[model samples]
Target: MQRIDSVNVRPDVNGAGKPGFHDNADLSGQDATYLTPTWLNTVQEEICNLIEKNGYTLNVASRQQLYDIIATNDSVTALAEAMENRLVQLQAVLATKSALEQGISYVMSELGQHKTASNPHPQYLLASTFGVHIPMTAAIGRTEIKDENRVLGWNGQSSDWTANTGEITWGGSLSGSVEFTPYRAYGQFLLSGYISTATFFDVNVRVFNAEGIETSLIKVTEYGGSYASYGMNKVFEIPKGGKAVIEYRVDAGYSKRAQMTFSVYVDDRVKVFTPVGLTSVVDATDFTESTQNDVKSDYSSFPAFEWFYGDTNGQYFELSAISNMSDPVNKIPHYHRDKFTQLEKDLYIAVQAGKQTIESPSDYAVIDTQILRARTDAEGNVVVAVPLSMRSITTANNETLVYTFVYYLNEPDVTGALPVGLDGEHKIYVRL
Candidate 1:
C-alpha cells in the first residue's frame, strides 16, 4: 500500500478547457495517496453502501471527511472491508425473499423425483398425430416410387390409373352433382367417419393462397383392386386467418355399382405434431442393442410398440402436413440446435410411463410435447431443454404408439418445405 502525499478533488478549477483536473502545490506537506478516478469511484461506492446500511444520510460534510481519510492507503483498505460485510448481508435477505415469493416449492418437487404414467393412450381421444396417405398420381408419371419415409408401405396390388371424362356421366345419366372442396379451407369444414368400401374414387383436393387461386392439386387415388385404400395429403402454410379450397370430384368415381365412402374427419382437435420423449412409455421398447452402447447402427430401433400390449405391436398414427400452419408455439421446431442437458435427459427418461430405458444402440427417445424450449452451449450439438408431454400407454393387444417428428426437405432453414423432393425427410425418431 502507498501513502498519499495530499488530496485534491475538484473539476476544472483553472480555465484549462478540460474536465477532471487537479493542481497539487499545497499537498506537499500531507501524507496521502493520489487516488485515480476509477479507484476513487470504488471507494465512494463502498462508503455509500456502509452509510446506507447504518441508516445515515450522505451529507456533504461526511463525504468530504471520508474522502480525506481514504487519501491514505490504510483507510482505503479498511473501507473496502466494511463495505463487503454490509453487501453480503443485503444479498442474503434479498435472496430469501425472492425464493419465498417465486413458489420454489413446486419447482423443487418436480426436480427431486421422477414422474410415472408419463404416456397413456386415452379412449375416444382423436388420433394424436395427423397424416395424409398420398397414393400414386398420374401427373408425376411414376407409380413405383420407393416409400422411403413413411413407416407403412403401399400394399395395393396394382398401380394402374385411368382418366375420367370431364362430364359426370354413368352411361349418359348424370344422377348427382360433383362437389369440389379445397384443402386450404379444410379447417372450416372437415370430413370424418370411416369409408367402409374400398372402390375407385376420384376427388380433386385443391389448395389456394390469399388470392383464392388454386395453388396445388392433391388427387386422391382411385382405390379399385382387392378393396384397397389410397389417400393424399397436401400441406402448406398460409397467412393468419387466410383460407384454402378442397374440390372433391365426387361424380367421377364408379358409383353406379356401390356408393364409395369419402369420410373426412375434420376438426380443430387434431393437434400439432410432437416428438415423444425417448423414455416415454410409447418409446420404451424402441431401443435396440446398438443404441444401448451409444453405437450408431444402420437401422435405429425406434419405439414401434408399447410394452403393455406385448409383442403384437405395429405403428399407427395419423399425420397432418399442416403442423407449422397452426401457428401454435410448440407445434414448430425449437430454436436451439444443441445436445441434451443432464436435467433434460433425466426428465425424458423419468417421464416414460410403462417403458424402461434400455442400453442399446437402436434405442432413442421421442419428444411428444407440442411446445419445446431448447438451448445450446458454445458447441453446436443439439439437445432439448424442455420436456414434452407424451402419448399414453395402451393395453390393446399388438397396439403401438407412433413416434412423430418433422422432416425438413431440401431447405433446413425453411420450416414448411415439402418432403417430396428433398434428400428424403429429416425425421427425428423416439419411443415412449
Candidate 2:
C-alpha cells in the first residue's frame, strides 16, 4: 500500500533470524556510505568487478600516486622558473631604450589588457581610418595602405639656452596625435639638441590608445642612444591600429633647442597585397579552408604579392634609410630622415573595390605553411603566393573578406652586415 520516498530505516535482524545478533564481529559485513548495508553486502563482488572493468585499481596507493603528480606539476618552484624565463625575454626586448629607466611601469601598464582570442600576437584593423589609398607603390613598392605620420616639436617650457655652457634645461610636456597601423608604431626623434658633453637627458614617452581609456605604454629612455636606435621599437612595441596620442616630456634633459623632429610613423611590419582576382575564383569559406592553393595561382592572378628581395627580372625588395636623398642640414640624421622607413618591395596593385562588398587589403592572416613558397612567372617578377586566412564573422549587411599570404623562409642565419629578423614574417594581404 503506501509508497515512501525516504524513510529513517535500519536493519536490526541478523541473518540467523534473531534480532540484535552477531556478537563475534561485524567486520565480515560490507558497508558503504552511499548504499544501504544490505545492498553492499549482497553486491560486494559486483562492486569490485565494476572498478576493475574500468581498468583502474581503486585503492589508497592509486590516489596517492595521483596526488603526487599534481603536487609535482603544480609546484611553486616550477611556476617560479616559468615566470623567470618570461621576465628574461621581456627584459631583453626592453633593454634597447629602457636602459636608463628603472621601474617597469611600461610593462605593468599592459597588465589589465587582454590578448586576442585565436592569434595572441596582433590582428588587422578592418575598415580602418584610411581613404582608398593604394598599399603598393610604382615599381619597388612596400608601403602601407593606411599610415599616419605626425612630426612633433618640443613645445614644453624650457630654460633659456645657456650661452656659456651651450646647454639648456627642458621641462613640461608636449602631446601629438598619430594614426597607428595594425601591428607597428614607430617614433623617430632628432636628438641634435641633446648632443652635449657629459650631458644626459632622461626622456619619458607615454603612448595612449585610440579610445584613450587606459595607458598604452610608457617608455623612459636616456636621450643618449645611437642615431639609428631612436625608433620606439628600440623602447617597446605598440600593437594598436587607430588614433594614438603620445606625450613626450623631459624628466631631466639638456637641449641646444627643442628639436621639432619628434615624429611617429605608423607602418606595420606586415605588408598588404591585393590579389588580381580572388572573389571570382575562391569562395569566402574556401579562403579559410586548409585545402586551398592560392599561392600557385598568384603569379597569374596575384601579381602584386611579393615577398623576397630578388633581382631576377629587375625587381628587388629594397629598404633604404638614406639612399638617394637630399641632405637635411637643419636636422639630426638617423635611419631615414623622412621619419618613416621607406621600403619598395613589389609592383603596384591598383585597388579595385567591389560594389557589393568592401575589401580590406591591410588585414593580415596566418599562413598554412604547406603552401609557403614563391612561384616564378615566365620571366616576370617573383611571386611568393602565401595562402593565408583570417576569421570571417558573417554580418547582416555587407562584409569585407581580406586574404593574406605570409611566408617563412627556412634559410639559415647569416653573420654579416645585412640585418635579419625574418622569422616567418613575409606577409601579404590579397582581396578575396
Per-candidate TM-scores read 0.18, 0.18
Per-residue lDDT tens digits for candidate 2, residues 117-202, read 24322222211111122221111122222222211221111111100112121211222322222222223221111223222334
Taking the tens digit of each residue's C-alpha lDDT, what string does model 1 give over 195-253? 22233344444554444445665554434332234444333222222333333322211
Query: Candidate 1, overall lDDT?
Result: 0.29
Candidate lDDT scores, in order, read 0.29, 0.28
| Residue 228 error, candidate 2, Å | 15
